[model samples]
Target: MSAAILFDGPKDAPFTLVLAHGAGAPMDSPFMAAVAQGLGARGRRVARFEFPYMVERRASGRKKPPDRQPVLLECWRAIVAELGGGSGLVIGGKSMGGRMASLVADECGVRGLVCLGYPFHPPGKPEKLRTAHLETLRTPALIVQGERDSFGGRADVEGYALSPAIRFTWMTDGDHGFRPRKASGLTEADNLAAAIEAVDAFLAACGG
Candidate 1:
C-alpha cells in the first residue's frame, strides 16, 4: 500500500476521510468517485486507496477477484497507518471496503466509520451472514444501505442484533448501488444526495 491517491477537498479542512474500494471496483470507480467528490465538496479531505489485488488489476487491466479476508484486513491496517494512525480520521468505504474497515476500526481507534451499500450477505444467501463482529462493534459507524438491496434489505437487517453504536439510513427503493426503480419516483441523484447528507450528519455527530 503506497501512500493513498487523494481527491483533496480544502487543505485546512477539519476532517479527513480515508476510503477503500469495494471488491469489484477500483478506488476511482463511478460509485467511489461520487461519494468522494460529494463529501469533499462538503469540506473534508478524502483519500482513496486500493488493496493489493485491485492495484494489480489496474496495472494489468484484468478483472481479478478480491483478495483473501486477511489480506484485505492487513490492507486496511496499512492505510490506517499511512493516514496518521487514525486519531482524527474517519475510515470506511463502499461494501467490501467498508466491511474491511469495520474489521480494523476499533483496533485503529479511528474517529468514525461509514459504509455505503454494505453487503450483509452474499446475494440470495441470507443465512451466510457477515455480521457477527458488527454485533458487538464499538466504533461509532453508519451503514447507508439501499432499501431493496439484494445483499441486505431493510427487513433482513432489522432482525439482526447489531451494535448500539451502529446506525442505518435506508435509501428508498434502492438496489445495491442505490439506484431506485423508476416507478419509485426518486432518481439516483436524490438517493446519492440523501446518502451524502446522512454521512455528513454522521461525521458531524462523531465530533471529529
Candidate 2:
C-alpha cells in the first residue's frame, strides 16, 4: 500500500481536489495547507497526500531525496485507485508533485488538473525542460505559475509550445511557490487567493 495523508473537507461537496506536496515538503506543508483550506472555504472538498519519501521523513526525522519517476507515478495511481478512481476529482500539486500528476492525469482520466506551480524545467537548466509530455496532453488543465519562477518563469515559458487544453495563470513577480517579492506590491496571500479562485473556476468549467 502507498503511504499517504489526507485532508478531508465537506464530505458532500460536488467535487474533490487531490493534492500532493512538492519535492521538499510534506503534504501538510504551510503552502499546501493554505491552498487546501482556501479551496475548502470556497466549498470545495480537498484531499492532500504525501509522497513516500515525505512519509519516511515523518517517521525517522531525516530528510531524503524524492522517489524516482516510476515510484512517484505508481504512488499517484495507487492513491487515485484508493480514492475511488477520480470521479468528480481534480488532481494536481505543487512543483515536482504537479509535474508527476500531469504525466498520469490522462491515464487516470480525472475530471481535470490544477497545478499550483509547475516546474517546466530544472532550476538553472532550461535546456532540460520537463514539458514534452505537457505539450501534447489531452486532459484539461489549469497551471497557476509564478511569473518569476526559476523552474519556468513567464518569459521562459512563453516561448515553449504547450497544449491548447492547458490554461496558464501567472502570479505577478512570484517565485516557485507563488510568493511574490515586496517590490512587486503583491502579497503571497493575495496570490494564493487568486490561485484558489482560478482553480475553483477551472474545476467548475470542467463540470466538477
Candidate 3:
C-alpha cells in the first residue's frame, strides 16, 4: 500500500517525481515544498509522502525518530508499486529520505533517482560509510549535495568509489540542508534553484 500523497502539477505530465521527507521533517516542510512547487511549476508532476513514523507523529502530535532501514526501504517499494511499478517515475527525497530512495531505486526499476543532500554517512562519523550499494548502482542517479555538507563534504565524498551511473551537482559552501554560509555570498534559495535546475535537466536526459 502506498502512503497518502500530496501532489503538484498536471496529472498528464510525462513523469511523476515522488519525493519523501527527511528524517525529521514532514512532507510539507519549507524545503520540500519549495522543491515540489518549483518542479511542479516547470511542468513535472511532483508527489510527496511521509514514512509510517512521520505519519504517526503527525496524528499524535509527538516527535519520532525515523523508521529502521528495512521499514524505510519497504515504504519506498510500496510507493513505487502503488504508483504503477515505476516505469515513468523518478524517485528521490531529502537527506535520509533520499538515501532510502536510493536503496530501492534499482529494485523498483525507477526511471531515475534524484537525491537532494544525500547523507553519505552520519554527521561527524565519516568512518561509518553507507555507500557500499552505491558503488554498483545501475539506475541513473543525480546526487545534489552541498560542497561542504557535514554528512559528506565534497572533499570526503570525492574519494568514495561510487558508480559512474551516479552524477553529482554540488551546492557552493552549503551544508546538509543546502544552506550556504552567509560569508560565501550565496543564499539557500540560490542553491535550491540550482538543484532544481539540475534535476530538471536530469529528468529530461532520462526521457521524462
Candidate 4:
C-alpha cells in the first residue's frame, strides 16, 4: 500500500485538494499545514502526502535526496489513483512538489492545479529552466509565486512562454515560500493570506 498523510475537512466538502510536500520538507510542514487549514476553513477537503524518499527519511531518521523524476511521477500517479482519480480534486503543492504536479496534471486529468511556489529554474542557475512541459499544459492551473523568489521571480517568469491555461498570482516581494524580506514592508502572514485567497478564487473559477 502507498504511504501518505491525509488531512480531512468537512465531510461534505464539494472538492478535495491533494497537496505534496516540497523537496526538503515533510508532508506536515508548517507551510503545508497552513495551506491545508486555510483551504479547509473555506470548506474544501485537503490532503497531504510525502514522496518515497521523504517517507524513508521519516522512518530512518536520515536525510535523503528527493526521488528521481520518474519515481516522483510514479508516486504522484499512485496518490492520485488512491485519492479517487481526480473527481472534484485540485492537485498541487510547494515548489518541487508543485513542479512535479504540473508535469503530470494533464495526464491525470485533475480538476485543477495549484502551485504554491513554482521553481522555474534552480537558484543562481536561471539558464537551466524546468518549464518545457508547461508551455503546452492542458490542465487548468494557478501558480502563486513570490515577486522576488530565486526560483522563478516575476521578472524571470515574464520572459518564459507559459501556457495560457496557467495563471500566475504574485506575492509582493516574497521569496520561494512567500516570505518577504523586512525591507519590502510586507509580513509573511500577509503574503500567505493573499496566496490563499488567490488559490481559493482559482479553484472556484475552475468549478472545484
Candidate 5:
C-alpha cells in the first residue's frame, strides 16, 4: 500500500512491537499514540502504520470504510515481511488491528500478540461473533478488555471456547476503547495506563 511506518523507542532495541489502528481511527489516534509512546519510554521499540484505506483518506481528506478483510490481511503480511519475518516481534493493535494480528500471528511465527481492546463481536449484535479462529489459536497472546464492553463483555467472553494460550487483563467498567464511565470513578487515562502496564508485563513474559 506504500504506507510509511512511524517508529518509536530505541532503534537498537532487541524486540519490536508493530501496531496498527482500528477500523475508524488512523494510526496516530490519541489511544494509539499514548500506547506507542508509553512502550517506547519503557525501552520497547514500537512501529505504527496505516492500511491502504486510511492512507487514501489521509491523502484525500475524506473518511472511508476499512479495506476488505483480504486486503487488510495482505497488508499485515507485507508488514511482517518488511520487518524481517517477525522474529523477536510482537504484533497487535487497538481493536480490528489486534484482531487482524491474531489471525496472522501463528502464520508469521511472531514471538507474541497483544490486543488493546478487542471487539469480540459487533456492538449489540452478540450473535454476529467473530471468534471462530480464536478458539484454536496456537500463538501465545494477551487481550486487554473492559468488563462491560458492549462488543464482548466479561459475561459473554468467559463462555467462549478460546484457546488456553490466550490470557486476559480485564479492566473495570470499560467500553470498546477501554474508556470507563464517570460514575465508575475510573478515568479513561487510568484504564489506559493499566493497559500499558499489562502489555509491558506480557511482553516480558514473552521474552521480549
Candidate 6:
C-alpha cells in the first residue's frame, strides 16, 4: 500500500526521514534533492515519494491539481504504515508536502516531524490561516521556514498560537522556496546548509 519511494543514504541508518514533494514539483526537485543529499551525507536515511496525482501526471505528462485533502492524508497514512508505524522516524517535505506531514505526524506516533516552508495559508490570502492544528500539535516538531516567505513570513507567524513543542529555524530574507535576495549577503546554498544543520541537531537531540 506504500507509494513508490526514491531513497538516499545508508539503509541501516538509525532513523529514516520521509519527504514528500511540493504541490507543483516532483520529489526530485532541486530544493528537495539538495536537502536530501545534505541530510543523507550527514548519515540519515532519506526517502521521497510522490502522491498519486503527481505519479499520474508524470505518466500522462499533463498538469493536474493536487488531490483533495482526504486523499492526501490517506497517502500519508499509507506511507507511515509502510515505514513501520513511524517509530524513530521523521516525516516532512517542502510546502504542501510538509503541511500534509504535519497533519499526520501526531496521528502516526512518529518520533518527530520536520516541515520545510510550511504554508500558513494560500498566498495573497492571509485571512485563511492553516494553523489551527499546529497550535496543539505534539510529536516534537521543527519547522524550517523562510523568514519572508510569501505564504507565512516570520512576522505573520509570530502572532499565531503554535505549540510550544514546535521550534523554528528561519532562513533570513528567503522566499517561499528558501531563496534569498542577493542583497541579503546569503546564498540559497547557505540557507540550505543552515536548514540541514538544524535538522541534524534536532535528530541528534531525539537520540537518532
Which numbered prediction scores highest in lDDT against the true structure?
3
Q: What TM-score, computed on C-alpha atoms, does each candidate reach?
A: 0.97, 0.97, 0.98, 0.97, 0.97, 0.97
Full ranking by lDDT: 3, 5, 6, 4, 1, 2
Q: Which residue segments of model 6 deviate by more than 4 Å?
A: none
Per-model lDDT: 0.89, 0.89, 0.93, 0.90, 0.92, 0.91
Among all windows of ten consecutive residues in candidate 6, which has the lowest summed lDDT?
Answer: 1-10
Better of 2 and 3 by lDDT: 3
lDDT against true structure, model 3: 0.93
Model 6 lDDT tens row, 1-208? 5457888889998889999999999998899999999989999899999999999998899999999999999999998888787896899999999999999999998888889999998989999999999989988999999999999999999888889989999998999988999999999999999999998898887778
Deviating ranges (above 4 Å) for candidate 1: none
Error of 4 at 44 (Å): 1.2
Displacement of residue 122 (Cα, Å) in model 3 is 0.9
Off by over 4 Å in 3: none
The per-prediction tally of clashing pairs is 0, 0, 0, 0, 0, 0
Tens digit of per-residue lDDT, candidate 4, span 91-193 = 9999999999999999999999999999999999999999999999989999999999999899999999989999999999999989999998889989988
Which 10 consecutive residues of model 1 have the lowest summed lDDT? Answer: 1-10
Name every residue pair that clashes in candidate 1.
none
Span of 10 residues, lowest total lDDT, candidate 4: 1-10
Task: Write the number of the candidate with greater lDDT, choosing between 1 and 2.
Answer: 1
Error of 1 at 44 (Å): 1.5
Q: Write the per-residue lDDT of candidate 3 for residues 110-143, one digit (tens) a residue.
A: 9999999999998889999999999999999999
